[model samples]
Target: MQLIIMRHGEAGRHSLDHERELTEVGRKQAANVAEKIAQSDSKPSVIWCSPYIRARQTAAIVGDILGVPVKEKSFITPDDDPGRCLDALLENKESPLMLVSHMPLVGSLTTLLSDGHRNGMPFMTAQAVVLDMPVVGPDCATLKTQFLP
Candidate 1:
């Protein structure tokens, strides 16, 4: 399985975190990353994103560029357990999947899958990490590349 874990684009500050939306620059950043992915061989077959507005917007940009379907997932929000998210991913059979989410979860999930621990590498807004996994489990994936926008 090829997994793309992405941080949502930069978002405007809001009193309610879930209601926060992307900034204008965030849209461009997402578009830049999407264009790059669309040109690559590892384009996702489907996009699963956090229900937060920022993540949904970011996922939409990439999905439109890659001509893939986008689905909102409640479990991918910031602070959600990476292990549970991984379990949800395992239940889905989509290969070459892209997950658009927030900072801590994306980083934590990436590390959990690739390094088998939550000592995560930090991710910038609109950054993406690609991993190739023979099986989706702890320490089973190899880092393929990273895309920065």
Candidate 2:
């Protein structure tokens, strides 16, 4: 399985954290990353993203570019537990899966999948980490490369 863990594009402040929307620069960043993915062999077959506005938007951009479908997942929010999120991901049997989410979760989940720990990697907005996993579990994934936009 190939896992593409992506941090949502930069977002403007909102009264409600869940309602935060991507800024203009964020949209460009998303598109740029999507273009990079489309040109590479790592394009995802499906996208799973946090239900938050910014994450949804980021996923939509990538999905549109790749001509894949996007699904909103409630468990991938910024503060959601990485282990629980991994459990939720295991329910789906899709290869080349892309997940769009926020800072802490995206980082922590990447580390959990690749290192068997939640020490957490760091990600910039609109950045993506690609992992190759034989199975979807802790320490099962190998960090392939990262796409920066």
Candidate 3:
């Protein structure tokens, strides 16, 4: 199984967190990243995203290219622990899964798998981290590819 964790693109300043949509540059970034994601030949079986508009919008971009449905996974939010997030992914029998979420959570979760340190947390807007592993625990999803948008 493969897990593709992507952070939402840049949003407007002072906008409502749930209502924030992607900016013009963010849209382009998502498109570029989507292009790269499509090259995988193995698209996500489901595009899981935060209910937040920014994340949903980001997922929609790649979903357009991958032809995957965008389902809001509330556990991808900032305060949500990655355990629930990983559980949701594990429950899916799909080959590749795309998760669109926030910054610290994405970075922290990645660290929980790749390394023990969170000092190098860096998930840029529209950037994605692709992991290859068994459909098991969070530790199983080792970092495979990091895509910058």
For lDDT, the strongest prediction is: 1
My TM-score estimates for the predictions, one after another, are 0.98, 0.97, 0.90
Clash pairs for candidate 2: none
* Candidate 3 RMSD to the correct structure: 1.8
- RMSD vs true structure, all candidates: 0.7, 0.9, 1.8
> Least accurate stretch of 10 residues (summed lDDT) in model 1?
6-15
- Model-by-model lDDT, in order? 0.93, 0.92, 0.80
Cα deviation of 26, candidate 3, in Å: 0.7
Query: CA shift at 86, candidate 1, in angstroms?
Result: 0.9
Model 2, span 52-124: residue lDDT tens? 9999999999899889999998889999999888887688788899999998998899989988899888899
Q: After superposition, how far is residue 118 of candidate 1 from its true place, in Å?
A: 0.7
Highest TM-score among the candidates is held by which one? 1
Candidate number with the higher TM-score (1 or 3) = 1
Candidate 1: TM-score?
0.98
lDDT of 3 at 96: 81
> What lDDT does model 3 reach?
0.80
User: Any runs in candidate 1 off by more than 4 Å, and if so which?
Assistant: none
Q: Tens digits of per-residue lDDT for model 1 on 1-149?
A: 99999999999996599999999999999999999888888899999999999999999998988999999999999999999988987887998999999979998999999999998889999999899999889889999998999
